[model samples]
Target: MSPAITETMIYDALRKVIDPELRHDIVELGFIQEIDIVDDYVHLEIQLTTPNCPYAENIVAQIKRAVEGVDGVHRVEVERACMKGS
Candidate 1:
């Protein structure tokens, strides 16, 4: 059997998704939150700096793409929320 997916692996994958405006990865930007894994499925929330961010859709797509690249990940479900106090 293939190796099980871990939070570390997921985070590593997420590091490749860069916020075009910030030119920085979401992991470093601390936007990733509430990572939950079940079997081959992954669920996570992304807290954007602003609710009206123009790039939100693109960012979510990138996040799905990145998370799906993990070896054992069969599905990725992403939710978006604006950061508190933002």
Candidate 2:
């Protein structure tokens, strides 16, 4: 059986996701707005620097792959958000 997934594991995995343009990890850039785990399901929010972010898909895909790589992750629900700077 796969080992149980933990919040630390999720965050650590996300730390490896780098933003192509910024050349920094999404976590480091404060892109990860929220993270929650319900049973084996993982629901997270990734806030972008802009609504029409060109790298949105790539970032989401990276997050999905990372989260799914965890042993006990049954599913991942990624909600995208935009935070436009003033």
Candidate 3:
């Protein structure tokens, strides 16, 4: 298999995505679970602290924008998943 995307870069990009309600980057809040990059497309699985997270959509959009802003990224796909104990 090819080398996986660097987790540091992924986390850095995610730092640009902030949660409106929390007024903080999701990365700092431990929201991002995984990131996969393939053929210049970024796939992200994000975990929200709550199932009814008020800023879920906004956070996803922000994450998409942040990832897409990366130099080699052609597309960004972000999926929101609820945290188990949330």
Candidate 4:
């Protein structure tokens, strides 16, 4: 059987997703709000620096791609939330 999926594995994968404007990985930027994993599905809640960030869509896409590339990940769901008072 394949290795079980874990939060560490997912986080490691997400570390590769970089913020285009900040030029730093999202994980390092602390944009990841939450991560929920069930079976092969991964749900992520990300907090952006701004509510109207131009790269929001791109960031979401990159997040999904990054998580999807992880072994044993069959599906990915990403939710975005703007930082409070930002």
Candidate 3 lowest-lDDT run of ten: 1-10
* Of candidates 3 and 1, the better by TM-score: 1
The predicted structure with the larger lDDT, 1 or 2, is 1
Give, for candidate 4, the lowest lDDT window spanning 10 residues. Answer: 77-86
* Poorly placed runs, candidate 4 (over 4 Å): none
Q: In candidate 3, which residue pairs clash?
A: none
Distance from true location, Cα of 24 in model 1, Å = 0.6
Give all candidates' CA lDDT scores. Answer: 0.92, 0.89, 0.79, 0.91
- The lDDT of model 3 is 0.79
Task: Give residue 55's error in model 2 in angstroms.
Answer: 0.5
What TM-score does model 3 achieve against the real structure? 0.83
Ranking by TM-score: 1, 4, 2, 3
TM-score (C-alpha) between model 4 and the true structure: 0.93
Residue 40 in model 2: lDDT: 90
Tell me, what's the RMSD of every candidate? 1.2, 1.8, 3.3, 1.3
Model 2 lDDT per residue over 1-86, tens place: 76777889999999889999999998899998889898799999989888888999999999999998888898999998756553
Return whichever of 2 and 4 wins on lDDT. 4
Candidate 2 has a TM-score of 0.89
The pairs that clash in candidate 4 are none
lDDT tens digits by residue: candidate 4, 1-86:
55789999999998999899999999999999999999899999999888889999999999999999989999999988767875
